[model samples]
Target chain A: MSQESQPEKTQTANFEERLQNSADQIETTLRSLLTDAPRGTEQLRPPKLLAAMQHGVLNGGKRIRPFLIVEVARMLGYDQAGVLRAASALECVHCYSLIHDDLPAMDDDDLRRGKPTVHVAFDEATAILAGDSLLTLAFDILADEATHQKAEVRAALVLGLAQNAGIGGMAGGQSLDIEAEGRDRTEAEIRQMQAMKTGALLRYACEAGAILAEASAKEQAAVTRFGTIIGLAFQLADDLLDVTATSAQLGKTAGKDLQSHKATLVSLNGVDATRETLNSLILEAEETLAPFANKADVLIATARFIANRQH
Target chain B: MSQESQPEKTQTANFEERLQNSADQIETTLRSLLTDAPRGTEQLRPPKLLAAMQHGVLNGGKRIRPFLIVEVARMLGYDQAGVLRAASALECVHCYSLIHDDLPAMDDDDLRRGKPTVHVAFDEATAILAGDSLLTLAFDILADEATHQKAEVRAALVLGLAQNAGIGGMAGGQSLDIEAEGRDRTEAEIRQMQAMKTGALLRYACEAGAILAEASAKEQAAVTRFGTIIGLAFQLADDLLDVTATSAQLGKTAGKDLQSHKATLVSLNGVDATRETLNSLILEAEETLAPFANKADVLIATARFIANRQH
Candidate 1:
């Protein structure tokens, strides 16, 4: 038992290292992307708006979505500059959502990642513009020729990102979740909302890697399915953490779901069942990537990390 | 004088009819695009968010941006379904900006187009999501195959729209304007702000048309210049109307610039000089389209209408 535990510990440490490296790389890429220098047809980047955008995005999170994108593309034998740019673009969308979500009218959280949120750090108006700019910047990055040699690829990435982040995906999910607050939502309704809110972006992260790698239709389907399963796992783990962890552990307010009467899976199914479902989701994600075999080691580890993450 | 005035009245009537027709077409296109049906990987469209989006976008405006896109494309000898789609996409961006700008933390306006603003109509959270969803939907529409057959065209449209609407363009302009409020701003500063805030999207509206028509670089430049001039004229006219028109005439609170201590050309140069500048801008716009000859008649009329508009 001791010997078996040693290898597992080593594997976990290795995966954490990989995750840290990916996070560092994404941070650098985002820094360059958010620089003061205007690109293409942009007239000039407003200094205050730029600063607010940097604040909202440069906070050190796990960058799990970017890690998934990088590792999935690497597993598919596509490691290129475009992959990093695409990952950064997705991170921009995620960061923008956080900024808007933290506004006074939304979650109204003053702290994010253990620091003042965008609206608190800057004025609410600046926060809104920063979020707007980051979202626009995402599409700009995806559509740029530097992101991909093929225009079709760039267009495809833009379309996919927009679809995932738009009304029917993340935003739609946010609407559903907002409406579900202070009400007892059915389990299925909660799942649907979760799938759209957090799950949609995570799914896009994996699918975008396939699109960038020019993976075959079958391989794309497999990776997409893998993404969908892990997305569920990620949300379930989040809901569980919200219920079981403290604000200090989460780096933001926790247990607010109960305070706000927000309907979450854990609220509906209890923590133990949610945990069980999360484990099953990780297993399914692993099975979905089985066809990729040894090449998918990092992606498989990522799924486990998502399912078991404390924050 | 009477005979000359009769021809002038006939021309004005014809131009107004054309403008109304374009507005009607754009309205239909927007209605179809904003339907409840989900498209392209969207799991579902939340009803509340959809309603807020429709409310924000379907408000009766002149649809000036869409009209410019349609008219410019027509001038370039290209009119198709793609033109209308692209026009609608630009309108979405326009409407989204208005929604966000009117937020309580921003302009805090209750009335838009003689109706309650999105935030007032629904809720602040819904307004933010609706604005976000509309922005995202714009990129989605531009990237779709129906917007343009060639992926290159689609990609260009996406890139252009993102640049014009993102950090260095409309959003950036908003930041500048916000910062300049309650402060003394130079004429140049005001122009730069207005150019970014209002000019960028208007420029894109015309540039997109040239792109769709695959017009020569020279023609594209000319049309783009026309758009720039008219964009300035649009803002100047708006400022003029703000000072001169009553609230009922404008369909919104008039003299808002003065009330908010916002800087504008009308404030700096006085109404008479600002009117002179507006006329010069309209003349410059007409001259820019001179190379297009008879094909540019509608566009020239549109420019004149923009400069002379009361609301």
Candidate 2:
């Protein structure tokens, strides 16, 4: 991002403005990355899957994961075009998850980011292929053309991403969410569920940033801590929104969690308690950044924005 | 495979024999790799996702992809755990694709390799997440572990796999298949479909073997040729089987392609034409090996087996 948006406060911005500014740049680059993607993806070369993927990945979302990568990279003072590549890779994975999550066999949703879901826009088969392709393409982008000369950092980035996205991370969380459907669970269980499903990817994002920056282990841990807390708060906010926010505003079929008989933070802890949890988590995330030597404002404010964003 | 049980001179020595031999060996050491899976992957892991993943991967199917990886590695005389690691990673991707393909939104398959489909065995959401996680985990297997010495090699492997599996490769093929659904398509379109979906991965598998073996670019191209032809033959056989085989014997739905009004090689070209094309392709594949100056009898036999296989 341009210096004007650099979060002058340096200690409290969570780099939201800075991150968004940088992320906007990354998104633009990502668009350039996609101008010829249909021809570029040798394995998934079908026009339908290409358009579906472009729809899923190119359609504007918050670009939060990519921003996190760039943010942490900046904190380490090591971001470059390489960081943008990693950010795009993370975006690809995140977009794939969204596409798959919206499938009829899964959440069965029909809309995403205020647009028709991939399955709704295309066919379910195409959506599944699109999601599958995006997921595969994400790693390709990260490993092939994404990384820089530092092999260790690249490996660390790939490892962090893989671990979070796999059974140990996003997959595990999603599994837990499915397991808890229609069943009441403890706050701890709910927390675990959210951590894996949502927190894991977010954590991966922060770690990718740290990795790109070649941050010290301690720094990586701090960012991880921040990611964990913020990810949970984000989930809690999402749950709360399901109850309080309308479909027109949220642009999603809210209250679907309840209709699915799923026990979210709102159902388990109630709106007020969930809000309290979100507040506490947000603070914890901010505090976690204290140990890091770099400017911690972007991550901090990112956490706050996640917790309180009106959506 | 003790070399004896591998495909040999006997006509009774079928692809199943070779596949089974490889499957047994890989399964024997499969658990060893899980030790390296993400540390927190199993904690609060989704039972539904796990079930779906296990259903697709652990279910009794011939580990063709893994076998090919090992076989190619063996051909290069690089007989360490690199081949196995690559095999495990390859299996993870194949399993992920199977899980997604069986979803109600995709192929909606109820059975695979003579077992319940992931969606049938578990819920669709679990299946989707399971597939997603498996895919993410494939990279984790490569990135988390310190198998490949050169990060470039690891990156290449990851890229190769992703390109083959992503929107342009297998997913691309699947997209074409979906688009062609209920419509007649030209032979070129059919070839493009098969090349993307099946050809991309097989070629990647071939290239992966060369890469892991540290084979030269020229050697890599040769294996790629073999893979391309074998992949086409494999798809042709699948098309033929859909028309000629019994569901009971095939271990899954039979003639479903024709029933669904989907076009296939057998549908586009007559059975005789497909047979001739299959022969020519296999011959081309075998000829690709000639430049290598090594006797790839097993690989050649492997190509021929692709043509004669029933299911």
Candidate 3:
């Protein structure tokens, strides 16, 4: 564990070579999926709202949620288009969350993906509507478009995503997060807040794909387990990076959780110990996927990506 | 028109009389449903988040959204508990919206339904999470507990509500609303904003019942139309009241919109003319329900309640 060996640049290249194709496949579709993606040529007004929405969703980001969504779709043997559509819909919700989260009342971050946050880029009100429209458009995608799959499965997957993203889940977690500020919370309470705030939707991004595939109860359980672990590990890594990574490296504001003094894994456990815990958790997650070894590589790669990435 | 006798006291009494019972009904279940709402609660650990969730949702004001939801369900010939349960989820979302809407960044209203806004009642961060949690809990209800319906139907309904409530529908409308302050938006734009802000969710409530009934395409279309008209007309009437009524009369606050210079029909049209337009819309809505003349008095009465009410 001597500074974790930085992947030796060549090994990093090799790892990118191994996973870059799949990652690139996801990235390309993500870019196109939002390119002037109008709701339709219908008479739906609010042209500016739509424009702001496109700006918010299309502003370049890693597209992590969609990548996971479509990866599960791909692992289940669906073609690129099918997965991309679902992935795009998920991206809409993800973008919506970020926009709302960036609102002055919420997390209040003014930059996203290395650019001005929606409110700052546009105006606060437009940013709000952009987020709202994106959210509604997400369901519209499932209901109106995102075809080729059974309506029922699409419906269930969309619903699951909504469930995880909403009040009792991610948004609620965020609320608790705001509440936790400047207050000493028990570790269990802190974990619960993080679980809801970050973990819930992250978990759903993985589970939604399996749900779309109509994966079996056993497969569903496995993916959920995988989702839960990745979600927590993802948050912890995020916490660690907030402490260790610079704003330039992380591509967003860093040390925010500490600035806010909100309870977080890093705040709960010191950075070095959190690093050890995160590494061990990654190993544990690998074990969780051992049963589906061949199909689990991307999922495994994603976990490692979150755990070890500089950003 | 000479103020049309101002409906004196009877209008409110009648409107309140119509919605009061349902409000009472929703209130009765408020505690039990939220506390023990979701059936399979065993696996949820620590339960504080859900408890905080229950804290946010339970024991609230008049259940206008649920009233509409259940009214629509009953209008279609079923008073099933399942429908009410499904409707209840929307109430949670609506409550969350109100809570968030009252936040400092949004409307910044300190009072909601004659009570302190969630943020005022709770901490700002807690209020954010409370609203966020309530929003998420809505979808979770349908996904986790509404065990009576087909997964597809449930998913569609849940997705519909979540999407509408989030960015594109309610939240988007609010953004436009916040932006349009003092900007002199046209009548059409004001109506469109109102439709999205207020009408979208109401429309979903009506549509949700239809989806649950597995209503025929034509019937669904008809119900959707009914919902659209009602939703629009309701907002129109509400705008009219904001001008005509005072804060005490309205039970929370009034004239806030006018004070903010937010565009409204009354703002565009003179007071008397706005009242006429609102009436015409109401008449059109009540007439639309004639096709379902024999189904449920509750629906007709509900329509009349909105069309002909004061406060």
Candidate 4:
């Protein structure tokens, strides 16, 4: 109501608008990439495979990882078209992970983003095929000459993506998480698992932006550090939300960690302590961008947004 | 014995020796690539995940695919170390496909190469993750500088691999294969499905070798044509064996295509006619390598080996 509060409200509102706009862009690009791309001269893709892939990717999500990629690229002055495809590739990997993680053998969740999970919407076989296609398509998109003008850059992107998504990264982390279910683990062990399971891809998104911009090693390292801190914050906020947010608000099953006896930061430190840690991590993330100062306003805001998000 | 029979026996002996030698090299290279690679600090891969992946890949079948990659690369005069990693990458993709295709949702097979299938040996979830890790690891190997001296070549290899392995290629073909179960399909339709499924990767392996060698476009096309014909031959041979070989010989469930009512070249044309067609295809494959003359001997031998194998 007061003048001082007005600008802060507008800033938050602006970030929301930016996030929505980026998601829209990603949706359009992803649709065309998935459906229209020629598999060969015959165009022999199974209609059902395409349907399952679209079902998993097209409907809804925050697109936060892609937004980071685009924002960081924008901050470094890369063309929108050049980076959008790359960002979309990252989203494909993310969507694939979610699809697989939600399978009956894994999380066994039925709801995602307020709708049926891919396996529930389609059959499990179709869901598995769809996930595989999406992951493969991510690399195909990056390898396209359209993603970047430099071959080295494209190679770097592919390499970075494969690293984060493979064993010792997201997939490896998921394996650890699965093993840790209903078991006790130290906080350090939990951090490592979370870092691989979720944090790896997030870090890669920022690193990809840096690669796109051809930033200096020093500058890339800074953005990467920023990415890592926010990645931890993102996990902390997610754990906090698991206990605090409702199923309706989260668009996924709520209180899952507690129900499944999954180890998490909130379980280890309790909610109030976890919140304090998340706040400090957000500040730490913001400080990592100090060299960029005004140019990094959106990124700093992104760190806070990640921490404070209710869903 | 006649004097002329001496050279014929020697040729067969030489081909057998060459095949064994190539398989040995591939097995050694694949083991090193899978076990020693540092994905990130501390080599944090879960033991089960690693176990599943290695079980799917190692101590396995003939290693025919990797042999093709290495032989083709050698035929084009590339260094063994430079091309072997790339060859191994393709084999990883092949192994991943086998692992997933054997899942209960897909072919529901319990055996592969006389050992329990990955899903049977491990749990279903670990098998899925292992397949995923292997697929991701393939791209990682290709993107590494060790695969090729030229970054452009590496990018091209990654793009080509993704294209063949994704929806328009192996996955698409698989979708069709799954849909075709218990259904009749025209010969043309069967060919198309086979081409996309198994044929695509075989084609990619040869094309990859050409790409690595920086061969002329015309030369690449010739090798690619050779790959296509052999891919067809490979499928025909497989279909024939499904009917003729015992489960022990095939190292998988025998007569599965018949039991599942899956369409195949043999199913459509009958065994006698299918064998004739396979022979013709092998000849066609050999003719495509005419440009290389004596340099093509190993490839020609490989084509015959594929068509004539009992298992």
TM-scores for all candidates: the values are: 0.98, 0.90, 0.84, 0.97
Q: Compared with the true structure, what per-residue lDDT tens digits does model 4 show for residues B1-311?
A: 55476987677678888878877777887888777356642237788898899999885568777778777877887655868788889999999999989988888889888889999999989988998999999999999898887899999999999999999999889888887777789888898899999999988888898898888899899988988887888999999999899998887789888888887778778999998998898879878999999898888988998999988
Ten-residue region with minimum lDDT total, candidate 1 chain A = A1-10
lDDT by residue (B150-177, candidate 2, tens digit) is 7777877877887788776777777777
Give per-residue lDDT, candidate 3, residue A209. 77
In model 4, state the lDDT of residue B135: 95
lDDT of 2 at A220: 77
Tell how far residue A127 is off in model 3, in angstroms: 3.8
C-alpha DockQ of every model: 0.90, 0.62, 0.28, 0.67
Off by over 4 Å in 4: A1-5, A36-43, B1-6, B40-43
lDDT of 4 by residue, A1-311 (tens): 66476998888888999899989999998888877457433236788889889989997688999999998887887765879999999999999999999999888889889888889998888888889989999999898899998999999999999989998799999998888887899998999998999899999999999999999999899999988897899999999999999988998789988988888889889999999998889878878898988999989889989999999
Ranking by TM-score: 1, 4, 2, 3
lDDT of 2 at A219: 82
What ranges in model 3 sit over 4 Å off? A1-11, A14-48, A76-80, A142-148, A183-190, A256-272, B1-18, B29-33, B36-61, B144-148, B162-168
In the range A34-131, model 2's lDDT, one tens digit per residue, is: 65445343733556567888898887678888888887888888857888888988898888888877876667788887899988998777887777
Q: Arrange candidates by DockQ, descending.
A: 1, 4, 2, 3
Model 3 is docked with a DockQ of 0.28
The residue-by-residue lDDT of candidate 3 on B194-299, one tens digit each, is 8878898888888888877777888788888878888877887888888888887776779877788777887777778866776786667667777788674567
**Higher-DockQ candidate of 3 and 4:** 4
